[model samples]
Target: MKAFVIERYGKQEPLHLAEVPEPKLGEQDVLVRIHAASINPLDLKIRSGALKRILPLRLPLVLGNDLAGVVTQVGTKVQRFKPGDEVYARTDTRRIGTFAEFIAVAESNVALKPPSLSMAEAASIPLVGLTAWQALVEKGNLRKGQKVFIHAGSGGVGTLAIQLAKHLGASVATTTSSANVALVKSLGADIVIDYKKDDFAKTLRDYDLVLHSLGSEELEKSVGILKPGGQLITISGPADPEFAKNNGMPKLVQMIVGLLSRKIRKKAGKQGVGYSFLFMRGSGEQLSTLGELIHSGAIRPTVDRVFPFEETNEALAYVEGGRTRGKAVIQVVALANQA
Candidate 1:
């Protein structure tokens, strides 16, 4: 199958399209014919080798994280899904290759796509949706009537998070540019802070949870806004020692992470708040819950644009530009008139 792959890691390097052998299907895997895939900031980070120490990928790697596809075959031990089942997934981190025409995903990490969404829409949900689910529900334990702050409210994760927080009955606040204030509000953000015009940290206070996805400065500010005993979960970060230990990094790496996050962790402790880093993992169970939410209209996929398969690199560039309102998808399967 023809797929786009990075021969080496470099920020300016382009992905080369090449014919490659099919992925080997495991006993617990399902072979999927990918219809659409989504671009993520993690893809850019991986391609640039920014995460080399933490997430070492084999050279000439295929680059994509989320996909919506149809099952073409099922492994011997796979029982939850069968051939012809429509599904979507954030492929397990170690087995990522959703940029291709097909992928063999572990059955435990795959979920049926919501019938209410198109393939492109479904593709946009898994990664960002799962990120929100893990951050808010699993880690934050955000409850009804509580206040939560989500940064970058117009971005991929932020858009879905706002909806999910609202679905969980939390009063949501978010930071976005003036142009996107309306967009975030439409997604159920009760308070939209225009970051370009105002300082969110100075204006918002006593939040039960702060989902921090920005720089160190913003993260420090996020800690101040959280009430005592509140959680400050950061997706972009100086990975803390807890995350390092949980992921089983080398002792040296764990020490490095601890030192990097020492300042923020100490500040959080002084203020009686908790701080931790989150690197979301794939989970079929979580995706199933998200699918129900999408199907019920409690949440909706926000697709900013869809590029043709051949323009996959362009899609990545667009996402990296950081002007997108929501997620960007690549239509992998050619339409009737396309070459």
Candidate 2:
């Protein structure tokens, strides 16, 4: 099967389409014939070797994370899914490669695609949806009448997190450019700051939680905005020690990770704010819950573009340009064609 792979890791090295051996199916996995795959900033990080130290992998690695497809085969141990079931997933990070024509995902990480969404649309949900779910509901424990801030409100995760925060009954505040203030508002953001003109730290204060997806500068600013006993969960991070420990990192590496987040954690601690890093893991059950929200129209995908599978490289480049209004997905096979 033809798949996009990186022979070497570097910013200059581009993913090349090559004939790779088909994926091996495990007894607890389902073989999905991918109809669409979504591109994320995580793909860029891995392709450029930015995350190589934390997530070391062999070369000739395929690049992709979110996929929506049809199950062509099911392992003997798989009970919930079978051939012909339309499904979608953010495959486990350790085995990510949804950019290919087929991928065998563990049955526990796969969920039925929301019936109301097209494959391209559903492909945009998994990673971002899971990120938002874990940040707002599970980790943040956001409650009604509380305030929460989500950074980068127009990007892939930001678009979803804003809606999830709203759905959880919290008053949502988000930062976006002038072009997207209206967009975020439509997603239920109670306060939308034009990041280019105003500072979010000054605009929002005493928040119950903050879902952050930016760098050190934004991290510092986000931590200050939270009130006493508030929590800040960052997906883009200088991996904290707790995250390293939870992932079973070497003690030396964990020590280094702790040193990296020391200053910020100390700052948060002084203000009675809690800080932790969140690296979202795939879960079939969480996807199932999010699927209901998507299906019921409580949350909707904001897909900026649908590139053909052949244009996966272009799609990645577009996402790297940092001007997307929402997510982008590569359509590998068009299912139903709008019925």
Q: Top model by lDDT, which number?
A: 1
Give per-residue CA lDDT, model 2, range 1-339, as digits (tens).
879988999876788888999999999999999999999999999999989878987888999998999999989899999899999999998899988999999999999999999899899999999999998888898898999999999999999998888888999888999989889999998898888899988777799998889888999998889999999899996878989999889999999999999998999999999998999999999999999999788999999999988888999999999998889899887555523
Enumerate residue pairs that collide in model 2.
none
Clashing residue pairs in candidate 1 (N, C-alpha, C atoms within 3 angstroms): none
lDDT for 49 (candidate 1): 95
| Model 1 residue 149 CA deviation in Å | 0.5
Deviation from native of the Cα of residue 42 in model 2, angstroms: 0.3
Which lDDT values do the candidates have, in the order given?
Answer: 0.93, 0.91
